[model samples]
Target: MNIRVNGEKIELSSTVKVIEDLLVFFELQERLVIVEQNREIVTKEEYQSTKLGDGDEIELVHFVGGG
Candidate 1:
């Protein structure tokens, strides 16, 4: 499937069907991060149920801290 990530076109396996699936795909499900899909904020609770379509936009932001 083809989707846009941060405005960049990328191809991923069909197995990725929902927003939360990305967590498993990228091995970040356990990591703390924020995800916005098509400009809408996606909560962790909704990630698994949020279905993704072609041409959809997905933005992932991970939290980082430095001293």
Candidate 2:
């Protein structure tokens, strides 16, 4: 399926059906990341239930520690 992530279009395998799977695919499953799908902010608890589809727009914002 094709989707737009952070303004970039990319194709994903069929195995990636939900937000959780997407995170794991990107290797960001363990990080503190905020996911916004199609202009709506998705809560962490909803990750597993949230489904992704073709042409969907996703914005991923992950935090970094420094100082």
Alpha-carbon shift of residue 20 in model 2 (angstroms): 0.4
- Go through the candidates in order and give each one's C-alpha lDDT: 0.88, 0.98
- Indicate the residue-level lDDT of 7 in model 2: 100
Each model's TM-score, in the order given?
0.87, 0.96
lDDT of candidate 1 over 1-67, digit per residue (tens): 8999878898889999998887788787887989999999999889989999998899988876789
Off by over 4 Å in 1: 65-67
Worst 10 residues of 1 by lDDT: 22-31
lDDT of 2 by residue, 1-67 (tens): 9999999999999999999999999999999999999999999999999999999999999998999
Best by lDDT: 2
